[model samples]
Target: KKNMVKTGKAALLLWCQKRTEGYKGVQVTNFTKSWKDGLAFAALYHSFYPDEIPFNSLSSKSSAEILEMCFACGLRHGIPRLLDVEDIVEMPSPEPFSMMTYLSQCYHTMEGGQKGRSGLASIQVNESQQRQQPA
Candidate 1:
């Protein structure tokens, strides 16, 4: 069981690394320390939505600000807020489980469509209406 958990974590980490590859100033080695600066999250988000998030503009922001932006964007796009910016910023190394859970959610959410420079196809979301559309 422990090994299974480790394997799952490893796979998630590898997925993150692959998605964020070639992103300048972003290196995802582990879920804890490597994410403290929030650049990893930014890179991952940018990978899915490059035009929405200008990669170069992130460098000037503080860790807290960067985290806020990432979380805000995720929230806007229907990704749940599994981790808090305050909790992440205050700790030297965040708890890996929470990070992994959030990242997995991100992966599944962003993996649904063809990706281009402009990002995924238009999504129609109506807050007042709850209707399912067939694929």
Candidate 2:
């Protein structure tokens, strides 16, 4: 059971890393410490809805403010506000399960809006299809 949990966490972490790959200053190494600054959540949100949230403009905000914006955006898109901003802001590292649950909800919410595949998978499929086409 422990190993299964670890594997699940690893997969979720990898999914987040792939989603937030090119966003500046956002590195998702884990569900806890990596999200302490709230940039990871913002990056993930921006990755799916780039036009909705300006990624570059978030640099000036405090961590709490950033988290508030991110959570608000999520709520707008129907993802529940699972993690409290105060709890996250006060802790050096937020609780892993809470982070993971919130992240998983974000993942499902974003991916559900896609055409039956994750964003990364859709991009890869498009690239492969383009490669197979004749000049």
Candidate 3:
């Protein structure tokens, strides 16, 4: 039962990386075998098929034990959710007037001018005038 559980977790981890919908542009630089991987595999499995199995009854070993094993690898060594992998297809250059630039220009025009305050200046001036008045 223990061996089968371990094997199932390993296969699931490999399968997650293998799928297209999996992490984009991620490479499997290193595969770490730890309890965390087992927990993650079980979690992923449960997420996909909630009706298949219950979390509490996952393994003969206590859930806490499994979880500790998962994190036992420590910060230095653990399974990376995604690794540094380059995309095969080259992306095209962005247009000169992209939405971001266009929005920035609009915001600047509305907020204030480069030389001095524009929209906010008038509001400040009015506020100052009101403050001067008794009230």
lDDT of 1 by residue, 96-117 (tens): 8899888877866787523421
Q: Each model's TM-score, in the order given? A: 0.78, 0.79, 0.21
* Model 3 stretches astray by more than 4 angstroms: 1-30, 35-37, 59-135
**Candidate that beats the other on lDDT, 1 or 2, i.e. the better one:** 2
Error in Å for residue 116 of model 3: 49
Local lDDT at 78 for model 1: 78
Model 2: runs farther than 4 Å from truth?
113-135
Sort every candidate by lDDT, greatest first: 2, 1, 3
Q: Candidates' lDDT values, in order?
A: 0.77, 0.82, 0.35
Clash-forming residue pairs, model 2: none
Candidate 3 residue pairs in backbone clash? 35-70, 36-70
Q: Estimate, for each residue in 7-100, the C-alpha lDDT of model 3 and write its tens digit.
A: 4334333433432134222333223322222444334333434454344465676544434432232212323212111110121322322312
lDDT of 2 by residue, 7-70 (tens): 5666567678888998888888877888888888889999888887777998789999989989
Best by lDDT: 2
Task: Tell me the spans in candidate 1 whose CA falls farther than 4 Å from its real position.
Answer: 113-135
Error of 2 at 54 (Å): 1.3
